[model samples]
Target: MTAAPHRPPGAPTADGTEIEGRLDEAVRAVRAPDAVFALSQDGRRTVRCGGTAPPPPVPRDRLRYELGSASKPYTGLLLAELVRSGVVCGADPAVVHLGPGRPHPRRSAITLTHLITHTSGLPPLPRDFYRQGLPHWSTNPYAGYPAERVVRAFLRSRPAHRPGTRWRYSNFGASVLGHALAAATATPWEELLTERILEPLGLAATALAPAGRPDTDATGHRADGTTPVPPLLIGGFQAAGAVRATPHDLLSFLEAHLRPDGTPLDGALRTVQRPVLRRGLGHRHVHTLTWFRHPTDHGPMYFHAGATSGQQAFLGFRPDTATALAAVSTRRHTGRDAFVATAYGLLASLPPLDRE
Candidate 1:
């Protein structure tokens, strides 16, 4: 495989060079294979850096990168739509939607809101999930597993804690939510996302296909820096981290979330972004139905990150300023503090919000 072409690193025009240089240095320090960073305010005054990837052949608008957990917000958005349509309630017991196959005595107490907030006491991933013998950090463990296997495993698994007692990231919880969404809508999960979310928002490049559905996609890289791996095919886990999208497409989605008045899912987007829980140390921060929120000098900021076998991606926005940032890296880097810092640094360079 060849590298994607390199775009000049700097501001949108002449004034952005300083901020662009900072982004370039940060991205370089992580040794990312390919990256794209952009900061925007009032839908203008944007600065962009880096190419899709280095040299071989990056598609023009289709630099597909696995969305990883970044796919969470999209799932959250779908749930929010369901909420708006009255198909499901954020605080309703998940068991009601999941049916009787699984003995979730406590499941009836866990709400869709708790799952999205990561407070359902579900572990980050299934305990036996690693027993399949895939590499610990393999970019695509679920590539070979089917949804039936996942459902069966989950049906017999025990909850780690009582519902809503505490917060624990749960890939299983998200997957379960996806299953419930499909069951309620009576449509395939991918098709529901396309019809209700992606298509409506004009996210033509975003989808749940693994190995990406031809055209737009970022190739996965191995930890050792071997040649890029084939696009990941994470079957049943698509709802957890299987999306492939570009920074531009993601930003449009973020804009719609931050400013929903004229968007396709206007009211639903607003409901999803509203704070529902206190998270992080000392509960100093707040979390919405799907997005994490932090207080900024300007106002509250919302964001999320994603990681797969060989890729990492981030998305964030400040509603008060109408500013947002989205980034993607072709190589894996688990330490996300640096990515968050880079995002904040980029946002700081933008014009401050006119209010608040």
Candidate 2:
């Protein structure tokens, strides 16, 4: 709705415009009713466009979109804190914490790193998760499922691959990692996130709001683009993708990732951004603890996207250039190609990396 701040000296605006133009084209092509886009370089050279909803005169701050899987990095940060405090080991197998009572023997070998990198060999979702019907999965798949059920489902199923052997992008793995972090720290998952990640960073707007909040929540639209759905609440899987944040708060979070110095979790942030697995085509697919890395002519960039019943969002940063971009769409467009293209395009438009 508001224009982003002006670009600082020595930053490349031409490239930034090219990327923004591509995103604008995408929004137009999708005919999306509501969307928000924000870009920043070292917290300056920032720009934003679009609004909280489609047309017709409702102007609101662009903070109501659901952050979807982008919440993983926050979960990863909490896990990192546990590691820093010596309460948990990044490489420790899940079995070590869940204990012998847990069902899956394969899980015995799955490490925190595996969960963070999506290489834990877990399924994207539980097999019987759909038995409850489409509304359940579509609106709030995990809302009714309890943590005990998650442990049971995990133990009953076998790993899709050997631990740490491949990347399959499992939301289930992240949920398990969240539980494990809480277990190791002797704190509730939400409280652990608040105390360690949110409070320290002063991210007051970021958190899993319970069912109702009056502050500008975005409504998810159906494919036909008419129906509006309530925000999906994944009960036990809160850690996997349950965060609601504004673009400004998200930018603050991304800033910490891009520039971790002076942060409480700098060591953990460093670990989270370090590439662990190569995925996608050409093995150019780079992945760190929770963030996905994109190889660019400028340098290695990191990003992650989130989606839910009603929202889609993306965050990306070029470490070499200290540039970051974040975007949120109230409507879920089927595939992620546009989001990826936008991020890559934006990064490409930046000035060449300075080889120091």
User: What lDDT does each candidate get?
Assistant: 0.71, 0.71
Cα lDDT tens digits for candidate 2, 108-159: 7899888878888898887877676366655666678877777667666688
Looking at model 2, residue 120 earns an lDDT score of 89
lDDT of 2 at 81: 77
Clashes of 1: 10
Cα deviation of 77, candidate 2, in Å = 1.9
lDDT of 2: 0.71
Which residue pairs does candidate 2 place in steric collision? 4-47, 4-48, 7-45, 69-306, 104-155, 220-310, 279-285
lDDT of 1 by residue, 249-338 (tens): 888888787668778799789888788888567999788888888776556778888877777778888775577788777765555435
lDDT of 1: 0.71
